[model samples]
Target: MEIVVAADASEKGLGAAIMHRFPNGRDKAITHASRAHTSAEKKYSQIEKEALSLIFAVKKFHRMIHGRKFTLLTDHQPLSIFGCKKGVPVHSANRLQRWAIILFTYDLPMQYRSSTNFGCADALSRLIANRQPPTEDAVIASVDAEVRRLFIDALRSLPLTAEKI
Candidate 1:
């Protein structure tokens, strides 16, 4: 038996799948995950987009794949570098380098599977709707606004004193 993870990115979104492959070549999909990219993410280069999909999938399926051996499948051939024995490549973008560090924790080997052979993940990526889930930045911005409001309210209630004590 073997664990197989496949990830793909499209102009619309990112998609990934986790599956179990039996010795006889039979495979069963455990789960399929996908999310629309943020505005900032959509501006990423093609390589970065693909790398982001891999990282997103790895994190989404962390519980099932962590601490276990697995095979990472991607249509992006350049991502195979993540599994190279020499380690992270120096020429990779800063974002990819950071993602590589995160990927290093998982004991998985990367493999390049052509898109035609990677239909499940490929379809999912393109099928994603335009809707986007609430982001951490949104939550943090709300919190910051609330704090600033409270600070202003508190200041308004206090009287200013220039007199020396």
Candidate 2:
């Protein structure tokens, strides 16, 4: 079986497309989308968008994919090879580490494709719709109470003075 996934994000919204190609040349396609979050509205990085799109595709098709090896295709070069390591690296960004952890379950070898050739996923990605907000709380979830306290302390020390500089 062959699989192709493409994702696109815009200030207006975010979207992803997943495809399963049968050996006979027929194709089954899946499309996923979500509106931008209030928080993510300000922090929607392309790398993050690519990762999220791929994750949605995998989870949506988990029943067909689980415990079996299959092709993984993407337009983003880095995500196709992301977390190639056996485990999430200590130095990885909070979000990336989390995405990697989820992706680790599949035996996927990433392949690169150009943006133009992404097919339906490209068009699907451009569509806007009403959906749940994107949750990207990996950084907050990973922080321990002690770390939070230290961060608070560091912020407090920076400036108690609230005057307009």
Candidate 3:
């Protein structure tokens, strides 16, 4: 299974999605996540906002993706420099340098994708967060349910299952 994480950030929020890309080249959304930024985060520069979004996505999906390699897609082109292939920047903000150190631990190769082709994450980032956000357990349960449903759907579509029937 090929895993791709797409992340985006807006002034209001950050959004990300973990996508499973089949060998046949179809992409499936394994899970999606978004959250409103804190007042301080909202004041971050554009690059900082983008970096934060990537960090959020990586940490959110860490369990499924930790030790393994994956591709990271971001609309912000400058982020490509932060991939494992490129060494950490020497002259960045303290906050960014710290984030880069954290990201380096993950085996992800960053790729630049244009905004028009990145609607999923873009829309997510623009969404208004609720006054009362769902509990972490509820969010996990929802993602688990979606993954289960997708697994069952894939199984049903297999020719072996059809033959058994």
lDDT of candidate 1? 0.90
For all predictions, the C-alpha RMSD in Å is 7.3, 14.2, 12.2
Expressed as tens digits, the lDDT of each residue in 42-97 for candidate 2 is 47687777777777667866776787766666677867556375565577679878
Q: Cα deviation of 110 in candidate 3 (Å)?
A: 0.6
Cα lDDT tens digits for candidate 3, 1-165: 989999999988999999998999777898899999987898899999999999999999999899999999999998887885567678888988888888889988898989998988889999956665678999999999999999999987777865576
Name the candidate that leads on TM-score.
Answer: 1
Q: lDDT score, residue 70, model 3? A: 94
Point out where model 1 deviates above 4 Å: 132-165
RMSD of candidate 2 to true structure, Å: 14.2
- How far off is residue 133 in model 2, in Å? 8.0
The lDDT for every candidate, in the order shown, is: 0.90, 0.65, 0.90
- Quote each prediction's TM-score: 0.79, 0.61, 0.77
**Candidate 3 segments exceeding 4 Å error:** 130-165
Error of 3 at 1 (Å): 1.6
Q: Name the weakest run of 10 consecutive residues (lDDT summed) in model 1.
A: 156-165
Give the Cα RMSD of candidate 3: 12.2
